[model samples]
Target: MKFSVFTASTPEWSPEQAVAELAAQGWDGIEWRVVDQPASPDGRPGFWAGNLATVPLTGLEEEVPRLRALTEAAGLDVSGVGGYAPCKQHDDVERLLAATRALGASQVRIVVPALGHVAWGGRLPTGGDYPELFAQARDDFRWVADRAAEHGVKALVELHHTTLTSSASAAMRLLDGLDPEHVGVIHDLGNLQVEGFEDHLAAFQLLGPYLAHVHVKNGAWFRDEVQGDDPLATVGWHHEWTPVNQGMHSVVEYLRTLKGHGYDGWVTLEDFSTELPLAERTAFNLAYMRRAWEEAQ
Candidate 1:
């Protein structure tokens, strides 16, 4: 299992700083966060806004070469491109794929629509029409597969919480007829703990050859409040990101399971917690993961 860092989690570092630090800290690759994020109100970098490590999508074509050169200079490979382009948007997907191919990266993330009551940018999720959303995602992915083949880049759908494809089986449903060579799935264990907790052995076995990549992180459930009255009343439960070693699921066992299954792919760290300083947290995750890998052996 090769180790990498998704720049989405390293919001404070610039692209150049990220490459140099990651290389010095012994990371194998970097997954560039490809998004056109809004500027922060106070002019400081945040995870989703004003992120310095991100590769802006507006002029990504012209920027790919410079990013590629930087990663190469730091002795890091481009593990993948982490984009927020929805799978249904062909133009956006194509734009990302073109840049990914030029950067010599094999895959780009094409997100599926949300499902639960959660919202994005103040817009409600598609909570009413499950069948419709699934059908549309399937159609969209078919087009994505065709376009990916043309570009020699594989399109990936991440199994995220509150999305149409959160679980392994659900992702498989959308990707049933599509060829794994052109399109694949990202097995994000952190997201699974929030919405789709599946047995590691079963989930991996189910994904089979379609599991092209993995995102390593950890999360746990928390109780925020308890509504009044009845014995079985609704309890406000939420999931929060935690340190890799302190989450509900065991990171060590997860890595062991992946190795046992012969998954020789990238395991990108995506810790979203804000407990430690940027550099310390980044280095800590790598060291923790390295120890886990060694202990498993």
Candidate 2:
């Protein structure tokens, strides 16, 4: 599989700088944010606990060509569009698809709404019971898939926390009902580790055929039981996000599995540590992932 970097971890750099750095680190491509401009110039949205949001749609018609030229100049591909679009919203889906087409991205990453309850106090609702959510998501995504197909794009549902597809089995169930040509799965190694290394591997095996993209991240389980008014809030408190080679997850095994399955896709680095400068940390993680990729090869 090829390697890429997501600009989410390095928001301070312009897209051009990010692409250049990633290419220098041996990345084949980049996943870029496609939301409207952030409320602040610094790129962090005040909402969502200081997390970055998608790039704004205004001027994207002009911006897309600019970004495409930038990546092409750097010998990198625009891997995909990374943005938050609640599939339930038709308008949001349309906007995202428009951005996807403009940016010349063949795929778009979307999140499933958060679901389930954590024993430590983090509780989320099961999306299965919320038929309307999936119904809306499916219908909207189908429409998106149709439009994307017209432009040679595919819409990928990310197997991330808080969505119906948080786990492998759950994610497969969702994919089984969709057309692989138009829709596929973005398998994340770190999210799979939430269930345990072996369990995550099992999930990967189960969904390997549908993996359209991959996220490489590492983390370790913490034994501390979080004490808080919200048990769900404590769920993340029990684990530590770490750089790719430093965590308990068997990244080597994961990459080996992908290679064994004849998976030739983008494996994007997504470690989210705030301890180091963003650009420096991205370079370090990219280097580490390259070593792992070489070893796996």
Best by TM-score: 1
Candidates in order, TM-scores: namely 0.95, 0.80
Give the whole-model CA lDDT for all candidates, comma-separated: 0.90, 0.68
Worst 10 residues of 2 by lDDT: 115-124
Best model per lDDT: 1
- Model 1 stretches with alpha carbons more than 4 Å out: 121-123, 126-128, 225-234
Model 2 C-alpha lDDT per residue in residues 96-164, reported as the tens digit of each score: 667677777778876565553322112345434546656656666667667656666677888776566
Clashing pairs in 1: none
